[model samples]
Target: MVGLMSGILLAPSAATAQVSDGGTVRQLDQLSQCRAMTDDKERLACFDRASAAILASRAAGDLMVLDRKAVIARKQSRFGLAVPTSEMFGGGRADEVTDVRQLDSTIKTASAAKAYGRWNLELANGSVWQTVDALTFGPSKGDAITLKEAPLGGYRATIAGGRSILVKRIR
Candidate 1:
């Protein structure tokens, strides 16, 4: 791993271009400087120094790295909430889609809200949602539910093949 990194770092023009373009992180900029060293020992020392800096930054909580799966799991767990799509997808443009528009889970529990006939639903995944539409039907415990994105950036929930109703996440 170190040998491959050193080879890539030794490409001075490319490394310089990446740094100047502001595409490379600060740690990479440090490692790229190692390419300027002519002696192998000096270059290795520079790489070590760069690695130590990266570790220090991470230890200080200035840097965090997450894989796609972990991020997607977080997005799924946060579904039904009012989080903007741009924020959820790493601040990308509004048109980007990573397939996190809906959530399917069985009802873990259900109870009446303060409003007459309004229901508060707790899904198996631990998200809490409340019915916003008129209470014509109430979801029962263990009922399969699909919470989908409705028109105008709202949520519509359907329980066990019943009619869809407007809903919002309360927690």
Candidate 2:
């Protein structure tokens, strides 16, 4: 009875170990693809797609897919965005909130201020930390901000006045 109980107790742990191993493999594969990519933008894009795919898979509740996606997301976040940790890629940690806020601010400021041209909006602690080129009432007079296709994929930012910016998560 003692031996049987021990085996049962350990079973779950063993399964978990296997899952972790599988996830690691998937991440490595994605990283390999990113490295093999020739263009800088292409590499970043590959990482983003792989990361997003992983997130979507996890949302579907497939453990195997979740594990693989998690790993790939971590790798892509690290290599593409210089994010030091996987938590930066939506790992549900404390810092994840900060990332989300930053992304939100980037979208929000671009939309609200009617800023045109390239603007890098940084956010921290639910507030805009700094705005580089915060205002550019450039030649374009339309409320819409056009985004060109970035190397990673379609990269566009547009601001509708007096409204929240809709930011589509890349990955």
Q: Which stretch of 10 consecutive residues in model 2 shows the poorest summed lDDT?
A: 1-10
**Angstrom error at residue 115, model 2:** 83
Residue 111 in candidate 2, Cα distance off native in Å:
71
Tens-digit lDDT string for candidate 1 (94-119): 22434478889999998989998789
Runs in model 1 with CA error above 4 Å?
1-24, 29-46, 83-85, 88-90, 93-99
Give the CA lDDT, 0 to 100, for residue 111 in model 2. Answer: 29
lDDT of 2: 0.36
Q: What tens-digit string does per-residue lDDT give for candidate 2 at 55-126? A: 544454432322334444344333323234435333443234323211211233322333344333322212
Residue 48 of model 1 has an lDDT of 90
TM-score attained by model 1: 0.64
Please list the residue runs of candidate 2 whose C-alpha ends up more than 4 Å from where it truly belongs after superposition.
Answer: 1-28, 64-171
Clashes of each: 0, 2
